[model samples]
Target chain A: MSAVEEMIKERLKNDIDPREFDKPEFQRDPFPLYKRLRDHHPVYHDRFHNRWVITRYWDVDAVFQNSEAYTRGIYEEEGPYKFGSRHVFGPNILEYGRGDRHRWLRNVIAGQFVGQKLNDFLPVIDMIARELIDKFRKDGEVELVTQFSHQFPIRVISNMLGLPREDENMFVGWYQALIAGLGFGGVHLARGIAARNEMWEYLEPLINQRSKNPGEDLLSRIIAAELDGVKMDMDEIKGFVALLLAAGGDTTDKAIANMMYHMMYTRPDQFDRVKATPDLWENVFTEMMRYDPVVHTQGRRTVNEMALYDEVIPKGALVLIYLGAGNRDERVFKDPDTFDAFRDDLHMGRENRSGRYKDGKPGHLGFGMGQHFCMGYAMARQEAVLACAYFANSLKNIRPKFKEHAGIFSPNIDSGGFRSPAELWLEFDPE
Target chain B: MKLRVDYKKCEKAGECYYNHTVLFERTDNGFPKILVEDLTTDALRHEAREAIEVCPTGAISIEE
Candidate 1:
């Protein structure tokens, strides 16, 4: 056997604990551990963390599909706000709500993101991408993540929500603090709470103004949106806006960074193909998401005792559907480890939302499925595709900037749960 | 076989088009359009059933 194949076999044979994911080495490269988990324990429980880590495609997809059996309300019980405050995410946040309330909130916001509404935002997204790229075009080398990827989505989201463009930095800081606070034992919980308060304080007067004098923006639309004559209150609107900032900003930023990382470092050939054919950006983004998604896992609580993969999970148990692992499942994708943009076996468009794989091909679970599928998916896609197309068209001789001696893809760290390089430094010739 | 879609209930999640493209196509605005309103083949029936089951909004149904 080849050296790489032998190394993989040896690593899979090692008895690695699921909790090893907390360790830096495993965090940097978890696919070896994921292989072991998928091969040995598809539904392994991490006793230390007190949660079930599901690794296989079918099991993860099943959890996403059966929302009734496994609800996102788990976030309420074990989330960072469990002990601190009830209003952290607000009562009407789409992620926590279930049944009719969830549907109403999703549909209301969904209208703002679909059809011509989304088309209108494409120019805004393209402009944001060009402006962000312009800032670093002169510099021979740039830290793409912090300088470009991180700021682009937040800017677009700020425009979409009718927020001031100058305050993008503050919003980015708030999102970072809030996401960090969501970590174990509320590491930065106080910071998160303070940020939320600050955001609400800033938004209250603006919301009131919009209510009195509505405009052609998302905030105004929310102020006007009603389901069966039930309008969202200030707190509900605040909650929804907070969720939008956190979800829309963090997820899309990481997605763009992850896609770029994969393109330049992991699969340069695919990157070249995309640069050659601009239309392939959609396929490249879809395949990149399947290969290395930004959001690695989502936590759900079991509503009742359930049996999966010959393992019985008790009621009220915390189950994490590992999207990264499912995306690379051997049973689902041929040579799952390799990143191939033209792979015919995987469903490309809105896979996670539908979970309806064409010809039984099985789609990636980057976005969750069923009732709680990501409401901002279309918006996210538009931003990523536009940004990617811009980069592919504008940059020449794009390549990763390796460290002086380490000879690696420039050392970078992963955030909690989400898998993305903290900083992706790349050298490119401005076209 | 008749394929029915509840337009009011349809969120345009796009399951039908992605799963069974031949049977359903999306409009310019992204809503699903049933191409073969009357699916007569057994193969089409199986595909339609899968689409119905996968629809997050439960907007699609098959009737004999």
Candidate 2:
């Protein structure tokens, strides 16, 4: 009924599918679109997008926490797009049912993420980060995302899962295809189908092998753990494994890329601080997760008709949680846009504030929250700290020399997340 | 009462249905479904609670 809603409807009608707009080109800079939706078409339904996108943070968070009212059905189920088939990822949304079954899966994964499982991965993360930094120190110029950001997390996750080194590249390739498909357009539908098939096929043998001889990987451990003497089947195991890959790989990879881009562009001084104190490297990691989260948006569906900020979201209508906007909300944070590394107030306690929250207040939606917080979050934080420490300790003299590129989205504005830097060039005194 | 489930919250680990096939089973889409038409008995209630606790999405609640 509103002009903006009418306009968005018209655009959706013309666009064929809202997801097609999520191409690498558009994803490179989605803020303009977000702004438009936020200002004018805030609650407009994109039937083509197959969901209503709520850009404001409060609305998103409300839907996030109110799981009972907003069913998480769409994301968990395999509709037109799923990462793998029954043959591969097993049952599509096994961990996503209603009733007691749903809680069981959450508890298992949550147990892995909540406390000690995270601490166990710390040393492994440190080793991997050092190895990467040790390798790249000689090369002054590096694409942070591809060279470092992307590589670190996957390796750590793969190692944690006890996946064969040989299969790492294969899984990474599938993950890219799968994430790229989230935009839900013509390009992605085809890519999604193909990637899904490939992933299932690839997992067939792996799943079979793991079933016969369970290994030391998290996947194997999960399979080995039985509920009252009943073991998880082959299909369920494959799905959980693939889901783990998705959770562990893409978001953290992008987070690293975003963090580096911000340091290079907005606050070279922060990099300088980390370079100077070394310990400050942890603050930079915390700030990065708080600053420009890679997982920019999340979605949920209202199960009961609800009024959000007075706007009625009908039961079953999709709602989005905008982490990107929330982190920068002027209302919640002081100088929301400014990147301050040495702010003691934000980093209240703990030994230098590396991973987990310094204040313990949900430090932005970097890893999300509530019933479905990221399971591999601790590993993600460890990888970030490891990468930063490696860069600071090893590439001591190196400084950023990123190209000047127009921002695709908001303040962060880069490919990895915010400052969509075409390339990051670093210069260091030759060793 | 056939075993009722909320698909959004179910992670499809199938632990509930594993113990009682008469009530719970895996669906075609890879999640689990409750087939029996009754929610009676302390055992059923206990298993249901376990399922709720394990659900990743918090998408389930027992309806007695």
TM-score of 2: 0.70
lDDT of 1 by residue, A109-207 (tens): 765775578888888888889898888888878888889887888888889999988887888877766655554235466666688889889899999
Candidate 2 residue B26 C-alpha distance from true site, Å: 31
For model 1, the stretches where C-alpha displacement exceeds 4 angstroms are A1-18, A75-89, A92-97, A184-187, A357-360, A403-416, B1-3, B6-64
lDDT of 2 at A40: 55
Q: Kindly list the interface RMSD, in angstroms, of each predicted candidate in the order they appear.
A: 9.0, 14.6
Which 10 residues in a row give candidate 2 chain B its minimum summed lDDT? B11-20
How many residue pairs clash in model 2?
42
- List of clashing residue pairs for candidate 1: none
lDDT of 2: 0.59
